[model samples]
Target: MKIHLSYGKDGLDVEIPERNLAGVLSFGASTPLAHPEEAIARSLQEPIGSLPLGELATKAKSACIVVCDITRPVPNKQLLPPMLRTLEESGIARNKITILVATGLHRPSTAAELDLILGQSMVSKYRVVDHHASVPGEQSLLGETKRKTPVYIDKRYLEAELKITVGFIEPHLMAGFSGGRKMVAIGCAGEETIKTLHSPRVLDDERCREGSIDENPLHDELMEISRMAGHDFVLDVSLDANRNITGVYAGHPQEAHAVGVEAVRRSVRATLKEPADIVVTTSAGFPLDLTYYQSIKGMTAALPVLKKGGMLILAAECSEGLGSERFTAMATRFGTATEFDEWIHQHPVDIDQWQLQECLKAVRQGEVVVVASGIRPEHRDKLFVRTAASVEEAVAQGLQKFGSQTTIAVIPKGPYTLVEVSRTSA
Candidate 1:
């Protein structure tokens, strides 16, 4: 059987033996809006649980719009224009309106990348700034949550008379779902705040996994942080597997995000009768698969459909190699996931340790093999997990390890498409 997997800019096709194939899991195909930009404009005018964006903008002098960095495939070019136009037309000065890239703890987006993120036309016209989590002076303390998680948001966002965030709704490994509160709580949070949110205390909770919302502690914490930061309005969209806007939600943060999440849950959830003995997954390509740190999401997202001791293979471009300096150092330092977990428990949460922490979850569950061509030769062996040269080679190794009886499942879209075992079949 020939299966095409989402990898890098151009996808990859590999031949999987028909006898071993369980199924290719993917999100339901959603039709793209016939007039997406017009749909976005209408969503702003007729929003849920709040006044229209234009009306809201009229009241505030300065507005701050937070957006996800390059890792997420948010249609920023489409989402930004209509909203920015509304703010400017409603009396907010062009200079007073700041588009803050919520980078979290990731590296700042370069000038060239900014052009790619928000088109050169928008970049030159608007006040665009990347949130620097490590810079202390850039953040302002917003007090603490009920869980005592410190809330430190970007000063530019907190100081703004009107706070807004634009993101797409998708299943998130830690926050239950991405978009809404996340664009501010984590994206615009300071380093200390980012560390606490990613620390084991929050993530170790069983409810923190994907597709969980109501009971997710991390989700609740993020909402609290967003509230303290005065998250006024949100404009979030739901995208199909092809990255086309399927649904546009604009209004009060929690209310509109809930609407978008419901739509996404219906579209992205996929299921199998039983756990697969071997699973093949990807980091959903390009911007997401650019680094190994981001690639870990592919592994964790497939865990629900994979047998506890199954051989799991991940294919990521990792064009930038291992990741940030701190993540690369931590990844190479510990020889095994067990050792790494032990050390992290005893020490303070270091920068970029959270990605490795999530990686440890996958490592503890089963054997993992990473197929990434961009990694340097020396760095391959140093990773906590094994590395393979290609997806075909990784599959061959898995078949050898798990034998002919082993069931193989493939998740071509990886983390973007949520997979789970059917309760009745189990």
Candidate 2:
């Protein structure tokens, strides 16, 4: 059986023996938008739970548009032009409008990357800046939320009379879903603010799981932070497996994001008959799998459908290496997953520790084998996981360890699709 898994830009294909293969899991394909530009324009013209974007922009002297950084697969090129036109038609000058890249704690986008994210023409005409979380002076404190989370956002974003956020809606590891309040709460927030929200105590909550929102403390805290930051109009888009825009939610941040989440739920949710002994998955391909830190999402997504003591083979490009020094340090400091959990129990204030902890949670579920061309073999050891030269080699080792009859599953799209094993199977 030949199966193609989402790898770098082109994708990677592997041939598995028919007798060894169990099933290939993925999200149900959704209908792509026939006219993305027209849909975006229409959404802006008739926004939900609020007045149209043009009407809202009328009284504002200056506007700030926040967008996701390079790590996300948001169709900014398709969404931004029409949004800018709407603001322009409402009397807001292009010079007065600033496009802020909500980078969170991630690195700033490069010139070429920014051109791809916002288009070369838009970059030259409008002011496009990256949010700097490490710089203290660039952020302003907006007081604390009810959960006592300190809210510090970019001062320039706060200075704008009107704030608008654009993002792609998808299942997130920590926040249940990504979009709406998250663009500001995490994207434009200062380092301290991000640290507070990503703290171990907050992430340890049961409701913080994927696809959950109502009682999710992380989502609730972000909502509170967004409310304190003041009213923000949002434009959230949902894409199909092919990365084409399938749904667009515009207007009030919270309400519109809810609409997008429902659309995403319908597209991503899948049920598996049983857990697999060996699962092979990818980190959702290029851009997303650019670094090891981001690649962890694919492992977490595959964990639910993997049986205990099973083998998990992850194919990630990780072209940027470990991505975070703090994360790498955390992994190296603790020898095993248990030791890492012990350290977190004793001290939970460290930044980026939650990500390492989350990675460890998936690691504890099964043995992990990585096939990363970008990560060095020596560095792979520090991650406390075995390394393989290719996906075929990893699967061959799994078969040898678990025997040929072991059920095997493949998640080609990885984190892009959620797998839920049936209760009867458990």
Candidate 3:
């Protein structure tokens, strides 16, 4: 197996045994392939002249903000500067513009972190505000959909004459990809709207497999409801394992997303056969590289394919503890997803019940779970799953259970965890 890495603009490949689960691991879009600065340059190189929204901004009479999703590793370097330049060229002054960090229910990015993400120039030039969806009451809805569902938008976004959303597209667990309707779900709306959009009416239905973009339940509705809201323009990019922009689409939300979706279909998704006896996976390295919360998406992608009581070996280096405070709080508070579902039904404040449930479910299904992570020994020992210090140890443990009958599924760097199905002739 050959594993490729990028330090700067250069690519370095490391080869390991095809059967060696120890060294050969393939990561997703979490890593950076194109240099961030260069990716930014490329996005800037795009001719924004054809876009209706860009044209609208060009002739705008007042100011509008460029609200870029800073969640995960959005190509912010490629996202902001050119947008500002374009908006500025359109007549909106840099000072009049604002950048909102759509934190939604996630932890807010610090000023230093924001500076690191948006670059010092934009940080110094314009107001960079973090959208606090923590307080649901503070948010406002733009209008009601035909279904009578209110299209909640960030109050600040409504403040501007034109609102622009920018984000990176990747295989997402709930909403298919990140960019399409994510802005409406997490960026514009309050928690109530978020929950409403994602609640039982949205979840508790037939779910699409993690890598199944077209079939995913949440992804289906998000697209419908987002179009209801007047999302002016959208810019989304499909990135490779190294966070390199493999594709970029900018236009009316659906059109742009369709273009991006088509590209992602060719490049990202993989299919697998079901019912593996032993599954080994890494924490979808990079953004999910260092955190337990972010890494859980890999497990969600991997789990449904496992047979009953099948062992799942998770290799996540959760060095940053849990990524978000709320993620940690919910993971520990509820014993199962059903319990969280019931709890959310009663509470009615949080946005992601399905997320809470999956974590708890994963925790409770410890009989089938094994963790070979960078977490401390004491912590690993205490976690619900059986813990191994290294990959060889994890695989060896699985071998003990099945001897030769065990079928091993290896997903190195495991977001969009792929399951392989093959009818090999005996």
lDDT of each: 0.91, 0.87, 0.59
Global fold similarity of model 1 (TM-score)? 0.98
Candidate 2 stretches with Cα past 4 Å from truth are: none
TM-score, per-candidate, Cα-based: 0.98, 0.96, 0.80
Candidate 2 vs 3: which has more TM-score: 2
Q: Which ten residues in a row have the lowest lDDT in candidate 2?
A: 327-336
**What order do you get sorting by TM-score, best first?**
1, 2, 3
Evaluated at residue 372, the lDDT of candidate 2 is 83
lDDT of 1: 0.91
* Residue 111 alpha-carbon offset, candidate 2, angstroms: 0.6
Candidate 1 lDDT over 1-426, as tens digits, reads 999999888988878888999989999878889999999999999998999999999999999999888989899999999999999999999999999999999999999888888999999999999999999999999799999888888999988999999999999998888999999999999999989999988778889998889889999999888888898899999998889999999999999999999999989999988999889999999889999999999999999988988888999989999998888888899888888888988999887888888888888888999999888899998889999988889889888888988799999999999788986444
Q: What is the Cα-based lDDT of residue 12 in candidate 3?
A: 25
Which pairs of residues clash in candidate 2, taking residues 3 or more apart in a chain or in different chains?
none
Who is ahead in lDDT, 2 or 3? 2
Candidate 1: the clashing residue pairs are none
TM-score of 2: 0.96
What's the lDDT of the predicted structure labeled candidate 2?
0.87
